[model samples]
Target chain A: MKKLTKDDLQAIKQEELKKETANWIKVGLSTCGIAAGAQDIYDFLVEEVKKRNLGVSIQRCGCAGMCYAEPLIEVKVEGMPKVFYGKVNKETAMKIVEKHIGGKILVNDHIYDIRSSQ
Target chain B: MQQKRILIKDTDLKKDRTRDFYTAFLTEIQDKKLEEKVQLVRVSDIGIYGKGLTVRVLPENFLYCDVETGDISRIVSESVVEGRPIEALLHKPDDKQLRLVLRNCGLVDPESIDDYIKHDGYQAIATILEKMTPEKVIEEMKISELRGRGGAGFPTWLKWKLTRAVEADQKYVICNGDEGDPGAYMDRSVLEGDPHSVIEGMMIAAYVIGATKGFFYIRAEYPLAIERVNRAVTQAHEYGLLGENILGSSFKLDIEIRLGAGAFVCGEETALISSVEGKRGYPRPRPPYPSVKGLWGKPTVINNVETLANIPLIMLKGGKWFSSIGTEKSKGSKVFALTGKVKNSGLIEVPMGTTLKEIVFEIGGGGIAGKKVKAVQTGGPSGGVIPEDFINAPVGYESLQKLGSIMGSGGMIVMNEDDCMVDIAKFYLRFCVDESCGKCAPCRIGGTQLLHLLEKISEGKGEIEDLDRLRRISRAMQKAALCGLGQTAPNPVLSTLRYFEDEYKAHIVEKKCPAGRCAGLFHFSIIEEKCKRCGLCFRNCPVQAVSGNRDQGYLIFEEKCINCGRCFEVCKFEAVSRG
Candidate 1:
């Protein structure tokens, strides 16, 4: 990549803003999250999303401050309310991709927090 | 028609009626024929604790707490359908945490610079380079009243102004990432989670101080933090943000990473400067402070990781906006590693002046296992303990200091009734003694003496006169110690004695450990009546202290017992008793 100028920085930010609003899954992959088996969860989610040919983008992020509820995943499906699923194992990750992403209904007993779109 | 969502959770841990409420809400929605229009989600955590039956109606984001099953139909019709909030049921949460420093923590990808820029990162530095001068930058910081988050609470602008005023051919700025507090990892989190924000903050600081070069003094223990920061620096360099002529301007700045050797004393500014210079990490006296003579005897400004992280935001939004959130003296939010006996042990960022009660009970979800909280230990080894009686006091630089504690870093360890005061004091004093760099006699000798007296007290061998000796040694260390390590090491001991003196007296006079923490003062015995002959104590005892058969019942061999309390913890029938 070439060195960015002032205008290039703004252009990149604006371009990324448009991409950020699409359907995406963010897994907490910080030290705290990784210690709680988030790496296996991330890998499992990535494989499942590819196996099912789901268009939802899977990404890695950092800790969300909720250390107690580790292995956290935040799912934002278009036209559905964005929610955080915590204490997630492989079983819960499959349910998130199938139920929340595929079937459009939230998985029971796993949703920790909901971010209301305002 | 836009679909409306209703999120429900029972915040009361004592009893969970969330499933029952979910069924009731489903029935009400089905009866009204609005099941297609409304989606009900039974969440595990609603971010509000201790309140019964929390219901949040999305799109409108109406939160109702302590809700009963009877209020379901009214909530469905009035709030869900009508998009109106009921005034009586509406829960307006006060003392809510404000996240400025951690705005992008869990939200953005740490490795992606585009993700950071999308969240309006580096915009402050760009604007600063284009418009503001060094004096103007310092003026803005002065208005914000942003202080050092590394413990001392020094004004950020004053440090910059002093460094800028010095006439030096080359100046330096260092980001102190050597956070060695026992329970604190706030800096590490910021570095790992949002590395770019800290980088931008460093750029803003470098611009203000007119420093061409800067260094990140991160401890080698945080390998992940180092990796992320390293990647962020490389990324910035590629984007023309780190090396020559940043953002089409002549303001060139380069940042390098220097790993600390995990010495607690290296966190002190003078020792940190020494460590970075390829010399022994020993602190020299102040007066020709770091701003005047730092980093190879040149003008240098060293800011904490959290303090530097606040700069970009403070510049982006005006200083008045940043200053409006916190108390009169200490402005802006503070990130605390809330650990220990709290129900929710996590990282929380709250505005300054939020009371300890609010932090512990409200945000932390109170003490673990429904136990009553005993006290809170703030600022790690160099800080003191605040008893439960003063939990209502607002947290500020002066407020915490007035309560015999300093807001050192942001390590808030919530201690419960099960934790012994004598043991807590001993733990912190021992940490200081172990970390005391033996360059100064006052710290080296005084710290060891204090630890010895604490050990004697915990072992039930302490005399009443030993209390006076502890005080005397602590005072001598405070007066004669070279650096912050030894001077503030006695805070934990002094604060505990000030608040829980009765517990200390009990250990001395009655030969009892009130909290049952001092193993030497307490003994484990099997209660014959309460014993079910389960043989759990006999099986679980590491030293084979309990000897008996299942049918015949058990007896504790006091001679064999090492007072490890393994048998006491294994007995489910309340058979094993300790006193």
Candidate 2:
């Protein structure tokens, strides 16, 4: 790879930001989240989304500071509000993929927080 | 029209009324034929505590606290249907948390360089290299009033300026990642969460001090932090951010990582400098401080992990903007590892002057299991306790020092009523005694002596004269010890004695442990009236101390009883009492 100039740094940032906004799922994969089985949730969601041919991206990030609710997954669908589901298991992950992604209806009793884009 | 989301949660811990409220709201949505347009979700946590019922309408982000079933139709009509919020039930949340150091913690991917750059990561260093001079960077830092977050609260600009002013052939910069405070892991979290930001901060510091070499002295225990930082270093080197002639300028820096062998005293600056120079980790006397003579007799500026993480942000936004966020003396936000006896045991960032009450009750969701909070222990072994009465005190460096506790790496352990003050003092003192390097005579002897006195008091063998002895030794240790470890070792004992001396007197004079934490001073007995004769105490006792049958009442023999409190835990009925 070639060394980045000052112009290259600015260009990369702008190009990445301007890319198409797709439906995505971000699982917190920090130590706290990993200790609570976030890796399994991330793997399962990736496999399920692929098998079902869903147009959703699975990404990994660090701890969101709500450690009481670990293994957290933040889902952002196109027409619905973005939300975080905590203490997520395989059953809840499947429900999220089927209901929230496929059916556009949110899964109840599992939502921890809703991020309002102000 | 976009789908309007209604999120509801019953914040009351005693009884959950979310089902009733959800059902009522669903019926209203169905009545208006807005089931598809409006989705009702029964959430687990609404980020508010103790409020009766919290309902938030999304798309508008209108929050209503203490909502009732009777107000459901009005909420559906006014807020949901007409897109307006009611004045009376509208709850404006006062969020006390400000995220400056932790801006990219959970938002950006730690392992991905593009994700970090997309969030404006290396822009600070680029701006510094292209436009600003070394003196200009220090000027901005001085205006920001950003202190060292490594527990000493020293001004960051002065440390850099002092190192810059020195005329040395070779200068160095070290990022102190060896955080050894017992319950504090704020450094570890920041390292693992945002490795590139810390690297960028280090680059900015090195450029200002005119140093081309930097070292990250992290502890050996944090394996993930080490891995991520190593990757980040390689990534920066690959992108021409670490090697010579960075960003098409004359600036050149090479960064390396050094692992500490898990010595608590290595968190001290002098010992850290010694360890980095491939010697035994022991602190020496200061006059030619680290700023003048450090790391092979060259001027070195060592900054904490959290302090370095704040530099890039301070440069991106002007220093005056950073100074406007916090108190007069201390600027910017602080990240705290809030743990122990709190409902939400996690990492929280709050402004410098936010009170303990706001952090504990509003942000922490109060004490666990409805137990009333007794006190809070800050700064680990080197700090003191703040009692419940002073929970309203703000959390600046000087303010915390005035309350007899230093803000040592932001480890705020919330203790409840069951935590005995004497036990708390002993626990911290014992930690210091074990971690003491034994290089100096005063710290080695003074720490051991102070722990013995605390042990004697907890065992109900202390006299009034011993209290005077504790105060005397603590003063001597503060004045005579070599480094910060031994000097501040007596803070926990002195602060506990300051606030909870009455409890200590009860342990000494009355020969009873009020909180029942000290084992031998208290005993367990069964109340005959409340006992169901289930024999659980007899069955659960490890030593077979309780001797009786179901027909006869169970009696605990005083001699064989070890004061283990197993019977107290095993009792299904509230028959077992301790006194």
Best by lDDT: 2
| Cα lDDT tens digits for candidate 1, B57-137 | 888888999999999999988888888899999998664688888888999899999999888888999999899999999
lDDT of 2 by residue, B1-579 (tens): 567888888888534366667788899999999987988888888789998998899889999999999999999999998999999998898888888888888888899888898988799999999999999999999999999999999999999999999998889999999999988888888898899999999999999988999999999999889999999999999999898889889888999999999999999999999999899999999968989999899999999999999999999999999999888887899999999899988889999999999999999999998999999999999899999999999998999999999988899999987789999999999999999999998899999999999999999999989999999999999999999999999999999999999989989999888888998689999999999999999999999999998999798988999998999988999899999
RMSD of each: 1.9, 1.8
TM-score value, chain A, candidate 2 = 0.94
lDDT at residue B195 of model 2 (Cα atoms):
92
Superposed model 2: Cα runs more than 4 Å off:
B31-33, B535-566
Model 1 residue A28 lDDT score: 95
True contacts kept of each: 0.76, 0.69
| Model 2, docking class | medium
- Give DockQ per model, in order: 0.69, 0.68
Candidate 2: the clashing residue pairs are none
What is the two-chain DockQ of model 1? Answer: 0.69
